[model samples]
Target: MKNENRRTFVKKAGIGIVASLSLSDIPAVMTGSVPDRPEKQEVFFTTGFKAAEVTTDSVILWTRLCGQEKPNPVVHRRREAIFRHPIDFDEEMPVGSMDGGVKGIGGSVKVQLSGGGQILESEWHSADTENDFTVRIPFDRLKPATSYRVTWTAKLPGSDALHTAAGTFRTAPQFSSPDAVRLVTSTCQYFWSYDHDERGFRIYDSMRRLNPDFFVHTGDYVYYDKPGPLGTTIEKARHQWHAMDGWPSLVDFYKGVPVYMTKDDHDLLRDDVHPFSPAYGQLTFGDGLKLWRENAPIAGKPYRTFRWGRHLQIWLMEGREYRSSNQDKDSASKTIWGEEQKKWLLETVAGSDATFRLLFSPTPVVGPDRDRKTDNHANKAFETEGNWLREYLSAQENMFVVNGDRHWQYVSVDKKTGLTEFGSGPVSDAHAQGWDQEDVRPEHKFLRVKGGFLEIAVVPSDRSAAVIKFIHRDVDGNPVHEEAFSSS
Candidate 1:
């Protein structure tokens, strides 16, 4: 892949320009560069692939197979048997280490979860053939909040095209406590630019340094459908997942951090394709969503809640998928969070006994401008949750909202309520555009469209009161903004 452009971007775009970083600055030590390698030989059916879309209790592992085109045009096919072997964290074996398993490749491939031993193997989907010849296995029912070792194998029909890939992931903790939860929050990755840069790597390394209990990728992991010609894919009208593979820097960074990822518009396919756009903003293909499922470490349930001891419980909502009415925005009934998710979030919040409740979103609930309101595709979790806060829990102060999408970082506290919102933009990929400070209400606390991450400390007190302090900083660890407050 051509990386000179990325190399140049990094050298020039330092400090906060998230998209400016180039691929050259990464240390050879960090990247583990290939030493004088020849062109890759073609391996059809199971040669091209990497593990992705990880979650706590479950994972949607995927891979691309190269073989005969779909609709084989023949009946009475000779199918091969395929099987998976799962091991506990104590098993330090590789995918190749496992022995005794079946295999086969039919354009698309997969296996579901059942009792401990591998048993759920169904006919693969035909539609999965066209895009990179990939298939997904949504492995649910695994132990929650625990680590697992997975091994996948596919044996070609009448040929030794045995294909396999191995990886590890920890299920979102099933149990929560004040002290066991460690979530690392960050956003705006701009993968391709980091295909060669180290800035993104540096931040991820720091996150690993903190050794967060779990990693939370707030949003914009990959800018879907980048506006220019350099990005967008014609066949799909959006962007492609292979773009992620090209980003060596990002892949390298994630290799170290066990990331639980979600997206704004970027990971979905494009920047912002609303109801008014041409052809429903390029229509999100199952293949694209499938790719995301393959890569990120998250639970399969689009929106689920996890308890972090008695001190905290986080309810992750699928804010974007069903935010608006299934129709274009013209309908009077259109909304950000559909009635179902909204109801669930409200009920979950009202019933929770945790000391702190957090709604982790991809976009800001209260922005100074009209960015999300216009994008039909933008998630409505924030707006919907904000409304719930106003109508249902007027004085609720234990809940905290955090989001990352814009290429900046800031904190704001509502005067009428103790609710505070912390916004962190492109972790390393700073953007040129910024939030209009003047547009914000006079009560807004801090706003800066700079690239950085937020460090939050929740300290418990004897009198049912808790102290929370947040410090926002740039990639180099310079504090740009800070705040502290007490909540009861």
Candidate 2:
């Protein structure tokens, strides 16, 4: 029940740095303060400049043609001093210009991949008014366990000169190799509530230092329903995506490490929008789906599993796409993961022989979530399937869940089923809320209601099959708690 130093530190050195430094070095605010992170130069790309859906031999390279050089801010006239909520835009809020929001310019881009003595360049692809000047190029048949740099050169409609931007990533090792890997997972970021104004969210800086092989966004990439103007239309929704992704910290982080992006309710539309749920103002559930797909550099379906070498097998779940209505009766027929997705999950997990298997869910699975919340597998609204999922997963060897949506950090072990879940709290300390520190439940093994992220590392063991470590850190990259499980 006590906090432990990072397991790697104890293994490598007799004594290691605790939280990097003392609290005296940090400035105090009403909620606390963002510590000084090691300075990483921000790489500027005006519009869609990130790589995602990374795999062994393929990656989705995404970019958009923005008219401006930097990310445009969301101009607001009111102060949200208390709770964060969604609201429509004012008449003065410019919806079509870069000064108020990102405006797309039709252009053509050529992408090139370089690394390990191999360089391949693609033909120029034109962006048009139809798709908002965003383009996605999927590169495949790549070499495994190799580093690659992707560079894109863009030519504006009338401009003769071409502008260029680049990003770096490493492919996953062969599935059968016993190679260790590390990844970071985070969620629940509000654009209006970023911790550092210039740096955006400090968690991105903290995560960049770890140099994880990959990043998993469990969802809520942007709040379509939360303020800086509620995303009630395509224009406002695009503004939400641009303003969030436009942050220097976020853009810089994605430029270095590739990510696996998933969608939850907030980013999807309003809270818990299902097949039958009503729209948020004029924004339909279908529009929400298109917005996510438009912004993300995704390939194939949202829910899929990936293997890192021989030891780690990670499953990224899609909660919203194929789900039953929340108002439905909690019977066998009423399901969170529709039949097809449920079948895929069971079949894939049972078929995989990896030493450690983890599922990245946008919402809690084995949670002590707030009683009033009933949107995820952890709630009583879905208790029938929740119990079944817990029992089924608990019986599997070296199985665990990492979830998002909750604004607090926690580690919970289901007493009856023995299944465990880790909650990666909000992306900023300012975004943390929901449960009280004194409201510790029976299932909670460790609880901290603050903004931060969870780090998962699969380190190969000499005596065991593999050792999976979950380390929780504050916004400043200081380890608050750590746990390790050695697989046989």
Candidate 3:
């Protein structure tokens, strides 16, 4: 099972959502919301709710007040997919309004928290048209490692339509506590390659079943450059987020699980984008940044770390905002992580006393990637800084890397430094590619050119050691590969 055959099985059977998870499997979770009929009937999108950036005592809750129930249906034409893109298009494409567009409405929302002994409530928060009809209410100073349920009600300005939804999440444990943590990580999601027309991506349903403590989306959540109609304008870019995040699979999974999100090339503007990168049509880099902040729950510094007890600490790296151009000469000064963030990473790694440290980067740091790739630390594009980072990481006693940009899943140990990395692969089978299944490298312990995700579990084995296990699961939630490491 620890090979490419597992994917071949998925392709043969679970190619359709009806075969994997039938629509009847989902109970209508949102109260007072109309059920989506089999006619592919138009139901009002509650836009649901998601938990993000959970800390020991705080979590940010986010939701959008959409004017419509869901994104406008996509327009697909079979004859005009001329570009090397995922979706088909017509010669005379409509670009004025958006294709899969769902606009934010002017409204206010009320939220209540009931988990600990004390029930907390909030005053009505305005979600105006200026902020994209989104509202974020933060609850702080709660108990650590505790489960909390959040209930919110959204009301449009004059309409009696009140949308009520509830979701639950657990905060991280205290740094010194001996708590075990389980989480799933995935990346590289393309809109047109959705396995189910209604569910969006089948993998979301799979990951939801694991019932992890949290989820990490390494990046490429939306393709600002790829088609489903290209996202060349700010309106189109905003359309990409709602269209992808508004899916039933995604909307439902985020209901119970909190998530940590990172941005990669596609998340920003286009492929290989840096600070000096040009605009994608009328969408400038700054505009992209603003839109991301509006949609995402993370507000402060983009790069940060979180600890899930004495056993595990994870550093999530930011690769886009402050990197030298990919075309720059490879030198010590060239960097994928800017000097400030790199310094912070080094200091945090050295100061942490956790049993295991996991570095999650949006791009690969120890990759056996294709030679043509130039945007990651594993490429010749930034080899000098990459080598320094690798050597430094190798010096750590119990450290591992989990990265997301690559389409294929693999586990590779750096031959020169003995550092190990796990690539989480793409979000679906149709979206997986970019590597040859037969061309396994000498450094690879496992390699699969198919879509899946990586799940890691941290458990206390004794007072002083912990067991960290990595399971690579296919889209149907079947484990294809498993690897384990023990604290030194």
Cα lDDT, all candidates: 0.50, 0.82, 0.84
Candidate 2, superposed: residue stretches over 4 Å from native = 1-44, 73-92, 97-100, 462-464
RMSD of 2: 18.4
lDDT, candidate 3, 224-337, per-residue tens: 888666678877777778778777899899989899999998988999899999889889999989888887798688998988899999999999999999998999889889
- The clash number for model 1 is 39
* lDDT (10s digit) by residue, model 2, range 1-488: 23465765575573334355466643465226756785422222565477777778878888877777776654443345523432444534667643236666777888999987889888888876677677888888888888999898988656677778888999998888888899998999878767776787899999999999999998988887776667877778877787777788888898888888888988888888886778887888888888888887787778889888889889999898788888777888878888888899999998998899999999899998778877888888899989999999999999999998999899999989989999988998777888899988899999999989999999997523788999999998899989899996
Candidate 1 — which residues are off by over 4 angstroms? Answer: 1-131, 138-145, 149-168, 172-176, 191-201, 227-239, 269-271, 280-301, 325-334, 370-394, 436-441, 455-469, 476-488
TM-score for predicted model 1 compared with the true structure = 0.62
In the order shown, the candidates' Cα RMSDs to the true structure are: 18.5, 18.4, 15.0
Q: Model 3: number of clashes?
A: 1
Reference-based lDDT, residue 452, model 1: 60
TM-score of 2: 0.87
lDDT of 1 by residue, 1-488 (tens): 25998877776775455345565765565467856755433223322333334444555555455442221111121212210111231122321221211111344344333334434444444324344345555665666555555445554434455444444445554333334344557777653233113232456555555545555677666554542112233233222343333233333344333444666666665555332333324344443455455444355467777664456677665645665532443343465556787788878887887777777777765444354455422234244345544434336556777777656666766555555677765555334145664555654678665566776666666435566667776665566787866665
Which 10 successive residues of model 1 have the least lDDT summed?
A: 77-86
Q: Each model's TM-score?
A: 0.62, 0.87, 0.87
